[model samples]
Target: MNKFIKLAAAAAVAMSTGTAAWAADYNLTISSWTGPNHGINALMWPGLIEMIEEATDGKVTAEVKLGLAPPPAQMDLVMDGAADMTIIFHGYQPGRFVGTKLIELPGYEGNAEAASVAYWRVYEEHLAALDEHRGVKVMGLSTHGPGQIHSNKEVTSIADLDGLKTRLPGGVASDIGRELGMIGIQVPAPKVYETLASDAADAVAMPYEGRVGFKLTEVAENVYEMPGGFYRGSFAFLMSQETFDSLPEDLQKALDEKVFGEPASRMLGQAWDEIDRIGREATVEAESNTITIASEQDQMLYGQYADLITKQVLAELNAAGIDAEAAYEMVKAEMAAQ
Candidate 1:
């Protein structure tokens, strides 16, 4: 049988034997969709695995396997036990997620670290009842750095963005696109480089890390940055319920109390903040790339746009029986305190 089956069989037999002091070792498989060089692969996964190993006293660890499935299919992959763990971008699945949008709303004043910690707290306090991640065990919740407009087309003002064909990851970003008069093109994150390079899209809404992660620095050379960004992307570090349940009680408790939840969320968020900084540096160092900070007038205009989207999204959540407005307030407060 395969290594997973062999290990699982051993675990099952040990558990059945009721060896109270047995220390079972587990190697979890983490499915990832991004390129091998992306920070999620090169940095986040390794760091998380280290946290897991440390917390479990080396009894549990994980390795990331890329391209097991596409971005949208990650959650289902974990549910089906094809992968033990993975990260899913909530927006990629569209209507499948509602409470998750709490973290994606724009105008939250903080970097990804603060946002992620706040996300975890807010999720526990208010969103846990949503049970949106039904089958999988949620290991952590995080948001990437604020997403800005990256384009080959010049964007010096909000008005300049009108009529631009832009790639938008659905969520508040799509609402923002509609308000800004952008013609939205939907594509997975990995396809961004080719889409822009081939002139299929004039611009993309992504965090700064896309500069290096998706080669946006080479294709979408101009960055029209708003102070708080157009939106943040929501991501969940998820594990199969089967995989989590299969672990020894001690190992599970260690992971739950020490490595998972807020701790993992903070780590992932901080990593995004660091990668965003690196992406900013890459942009400055690139020959043709330019960053145009939104003018005061443009920032004001975008704020109005953000307000409208925020109201509509919260109303949708409220209709679905979530106290989204209260959760929204908590998110903002938590982020600020962080």
Candidate 2:
């Protein structure tokens, strides 16, 4: 009788442990529109996933699903619970995102890491009022490296861009294209290679990483770089509010404290900086592509036009009651400190 009782007790304990284990495990699905080999998918997502698993003590984890939706549809996918999380390019939605364009404006002098950290801080302190991400939990914010002109032909001066059909991502990039008198072709990053290959665009305004990430080195063999670049692009990592709310309180706290916000943003930005370095090195090693440093006079002219766009954006934001100037100053200061 005593042996039988002990056996029964052991069985009950094992069943309870199994039940607890099952309850603790949560799986999150991340939707990515970029190619799997892209830095975000290859480095950033894996790093973030590891952080999540570590922070949650193995109770929660994530997996990335490619082409779950197109880039512009990401935010809506997460909001609608079609995907648990996604990264959004602020410029992709145009008028739907105004304050985010502040980070996209030119003249910020910093690598992706510093800019990304500052972006998160600025959003928390100032841009949160815009509530542009109302339906989702903002996991983090980041900026890619500086945007430079990449083309198949040598571009020595601003005049070279005039009347050239260039691929512009959107938002301030489009605005800058207009200012420079370039005929703009709008396309997502993934399509850039084919667009250039098919002669749809003569040039593209993108970061150094594009040379390799989008296989631009094979098509666009010349890069025109300005001191601080013509502009930067803003990106956000977001989570579904409903999915987050479904997590256990402890898991939620763990994600908030360790895996989300500034930490994740910094990780992603650092990855971009590293990948950009690799891309630059690859382009140089190829010896097929040419790097053109914009002349001092050309840089000055680009800077002046960039300033006009900045002022126009700030004025619009201020008109919308966002204290745009103060926010812009804060971004500068935060980035400098970083």
Candidate 2 local lDDT, 226-306, one digit each (tens): 878889999999999999999989999999999899999999899889768867876787778888888989888888899
Off by over 4 Å in 1: 1-24
Q: lDDT for every model?
A: 0.88, 0.85
- Model 1: ten consecutive residues of lowest lDDT: 13-22
Q: Model 1, residue 277: displacement in angstroms?
A: 0.1
Clashing pairs in 2: none
Q: After superposition, how far is residue 13 of candidate 2 from its true place, in Å?
A: 35
lDDT of 1 at 213: 79
Could you give me the TM-score of model 1 versus the true structure? 0.92
> Top lDDT: which candidate number?
1
